[model samples]
Target: MTVHTAPAPAATMFDVRNPGTGDVVGQYPVHGEPEVAAAVERAREAAVWWDGIGFDERRKRLDAFRGVIARRINQLAGVIHEEMGKPHGDAYLEVALVLDHLAWAAKNAGKVLGKRKAHAGPLNANLGATVEHKALGVVGVIGPWNYPVFTPMGSIVYALAAGNTIVFKPSEYTPGVGAWLVDAFSQVVPEHPVMQLVTGDGSTGAALCRAGVDKVAFTGSTATAKRVMATCAETLTPIVAECGGKDALLVDQDADLEAAADAAVWGGIANAGQSCIGVERIYVHTAVHDAFEAMLADRVGALRAGADSGALVGPITMPSQVEIIRRHVADAVASGGRIVAGSGSIDGQVVQPVLLADVPEDAAAVREETFGPTLTLRRVEDMDEAVRLTNASRYHLAASVFSKHHGTAIADRIRSGMVAVNSVFSFAVVASIPFGGVGDSGFGRIHGEEGLREFCYAHSVVRQKFASPLPLMSFGRTAKVEERLGTIIALVHGSK
Candidate 1:
């Protein structure tokens, strides 16, 4: 006799709270394994219909989805600000960039993924060969809360453009934003659940990994990413992880001190420094270290963390992150590091910017990813020393180099997947450049041509146009024919 077990039922419910205030914003059901598996099955069914439609029709639908998002950009931004605690302006910027990516993916999908002719070598003179990229049937996306709209949309938009359906499991901290996005998309394409949403905590995410989707896309911390990978490994499911990073910024002696200071302040403290590619460490040449430190301190002093309308920095989104931020600051100061700018203080969820100078490379503040409004400054003897220090970390996601004459040369030496020359975070806004990292920062890309193909599968086709002059594949080949073939191979390839 064979045994069969029933799917698990939906479990408990949780409340979404505003981090700035401890008030409950909304409530969501904690979907269980059964719900997650059902969502993936529906996505699988929808993928068939979605892929059957031609690229032109798919473009129309995707463009319509983009239109819906654009029209309600402010509304979506409001949700992001409320749930994730980022400033309204910063939230708006996140949504705007997502819109740009959507437009690029819809416009370039056909040209990038369509079938193209391939040249058949002289050895196969009578064959026609071509290659095309097809959609992976269904994709599972586990998103993050920091930049909820922009980060997950990097996978969602590309997957949809590639003609695959999506079952998105957003971070438990920001389910409202995810629900809003899916609702807006549904208004555009209502026939099928082309883009579905399943709200829950980590258990739901783990379930999605075991739900048999064609591929899973995850964006989170390095520690959490490992757990996600382990769960996916149980089912032999493929996953793309855009994990954490302790990114760095390098300033050469020839660099503009004012510009470097400005970039450092913004890159390190923006969004309360919650971004994966956010600048956590700054390595400046010893010659200009003092001047740069002064300018950065002034900039940091001008910034304030509050929930008020005039405040530029918002409160920390995740509650657990506040302790980590405090620990890193305490650790830096305990290791003989000097506080240069704002005090390393935290009152409730709002944490003021903490700038530390002369911190050792081995300190936790410099070694681990402190996803808060904190910056550590270090002085290096030369650009070589700066590059050496920058490349010495375990996490290498993105980096920035500020140099007057050797920006490109300095950028090339860094081990990060992407680097900005004379700028910071510039690679993220550009739709054509790939976004991802190597090593502990996580593998697999999420943007550009590589990103569009990330949710797709390559397909090749070959056809015989006529019979070959020499029948080598046949079992009845004469010994003389085999000898002639060997002689021809030796004459053509032996010299090389």
Candidate 2:
């Protein structure tokens, strides 16, 4: 099928389509450099008005923004359901989760970013030092098509709450949802352009990075992240990359086979398995591998993909992803894996659920991210091997460990950002845990205290009540005082 490009603009806008039916959803402006530059200029003006409002007033406005989203959850979910082809209920859940993060950011921003007294130690106690977390200036956010609401909002809300103005570039595939969110925030803070939308394709994202924004926040593939970093490097723009994850799940022999199988199916197939933290591999204990695979096959076989009520799986969001999915499955099968459920093509967007067992370690299906409704099962001799193989991949985003007694220990050993001991995607729902990855999965964090700080910079300040008998910063400082300071520091923090 030929991919439909976005409608014509002064610049070419991306064509947004409904994945399940291949219907044209809508089109948006492909904002050019001039428009985005203007948006950032406006955002700067807005930041003054916004940052001056102080935390209390901003908190109220942010809360009102949350209400706007909460009241219209289903309406937003419908757009997500169509544009991304996630199940309606699941889409609703995604929107609701965004609202929760918005609330968390607003409620916690002051405490996290506010100026606070820091221990000056014996040396600096007389210096009256304090540490302040200040917002970085205008921030540029480049969003992804999958989980359009939840993903970008992770950056947008946190950035705004920390007093930074946001100029967002949403995925062209789901610009409507992005526009709706900005519009909702406007209703609460009409006085400032605190959060503005700059809709376009990769060029727009490129514009935002070089358009003089202080920093950029990106969520996408690692390959693209390297490019984004290179672009930002030109301007020395610091970036937070929340990229892809080839996450794994390790099952110990003592694990509940039924629970492990259930998690494997859900983690690999939810949202048609398009999640960044989606479970892509299963390293089952040899003792229980057969039982787990049998149960997984039974469960995954009953799953359906469509725009209908009975559908559990949904269409592939991006059309180009079709060939990628087919290739992964074909590679695994040819590498001696067996498909126990649906396989092959379905239509323009929808693809069938697939289960592969006995897949070789070197198969592309096991080693890379296919981002579709597929699972590769391999047996390991023991839990030790499970941990080793699970961490073998360069990507360490999220993982799950299912063991009745050793779940937490096994979870801690897996080298992923977040792990669920006996659940699936629980970290996302928790609201207080940091969400991000290590290595190829990308760096920086976007939830909890860490998320709150991602948008701010630390500042240290000191005030003197009187002329210090021991002065530092001044050329007049005595060498005798310098020696005393060294002794003081060693007496305090350097103690053994």
Candidate 3:
């Protein structure tokens, strides 16, 4: 007798909508485990050819990819704007910043990862040592939606420069942006699928993590990071997570209040405040608290959030984030805080930028990552108090300090991964400095020399130039040889 088996269910497709206009920008398949695994398999085969090419050839191809991005920057920016709900100009700026990083990674990869001579210690003087960083096969990159082009490129570009093929799983909200990136890369390096795209939701990302990729580079919330970590733990796969933050901005007594106010408004509300390193808290020195607060209120009050061309702030990209913003605002007001600038109204996905004053330290608005166009301001007795309050948060991702005379001193006291002195978010623009945080912000880094090494593993080699006189590593060693070695070591190292 013969038995009939049921067929597997078909994979579903989802629409990408614009938060500002409520229009479907694109539709993508919810790539499941099978599709994700197939993409990784292709990447693995491509990795072999990618790694075989010398650094000079890789640099030339990477430069060509950079050229593709530069020539079509406006088209890519438009996709980012439509899919992620940011202003078109801001999207252009985001894509423009990525060009600098792409160039830096391409130009510096050889210098950073090339083989170099390593010193052998006195005990092994007759041995020669060398070290280099080699590609770790295929890499899985899980990107965020807020800054779609910029954030993921921190991983994709660096990993590519280091000679690893990539399988990118972009956030569901902005799959079009990811597709555009992959297509553009293919135009430059058409020989193989050096970089590929797999669009889907959380399940797709989990599948990539479990698909035997050499490494996973993820950027998202701390809560979600835990889940990714758990999934990767199943296979003991290594990962680098760049998570969320509740960053702070400090104002010293001698700070330029005008500049501080400008930085606070831009840092707190830009991109509708969806940045992981966005300024969510402000600690001002009492001497200039009143003046700085007045300037910040005036500037923020003039800004508006909408789909209009002139609106400085855009709609919240993710719909669920609106509820979080609403809850934080209500909690701040109910806990004795007053809205200093905004109307505190949530109209659809457009949340007017709100500035809160006198919120308690333990309030949800102050302690949590609001992820909205909101700011909570508090006055402190001095710079010492400012530093203390700034370092109190569980998220130590990034911070900005404004002081005419003591900018560096105050920045040094704050405990965070990257600090901007007399400015805001400047560190992220520079390609040489590393970006990532300690504690809840997640471990491992992206961007800079450290980021290049993140996707590669160190390879060490030792060669013997001559036999050691003492032959410490030999089985034929005798007591007399050991005695002479002890006396020589004591003579060399006994005196401090």
Best by lDDT: 3
Model 1: per-residue Cα lDDT over 92-154, one tens digit each = 999998878998989999899999999998677889999999999899999999999999999
Per-residue lDDT for 1-496 in model 2, tens only?
1111112355565678887777798878888888888888888887888877877777898899899899999999988887788889999989888878888888888888898987766555456878878888899999999889999988888888888898888887888888777877778877667888888888888988889998899999999999999999998999999999888988888888888788889888999889998989989889988888889889988888877767888888888888899899998988888897767456767888888888888888888888999888888999999899888998999999898999998988888889999887889877777999999999999888898788888999888756666778798888898998888778776977
True-structure Cα RMSD, model 2:
3.8
Judged by whole-model lDDT over C-alpha atoms, candidate 1 comes out at: 0.90
Candidate numbers, best lDDT first, in rank order: 3, 1, 2
Question: Model 3: number of clashes?
Answer: 0
Q: Quote the lDDT for 189 in model 1.
A: 76
Q: What are the TM-scores, per candidate, against the unseen true structure?
A: 0.97, 0.94, 0.97
lDDT of 3 at 111: 96
Model 2: ten consecutive residues of lowest lDDT: 1-10
TM-score of 3: 0.97
Where in model 3 is the C-alpha error above 4 Å?
A: 1-11
Pick by TM-score: 1 or 2, better one: 1
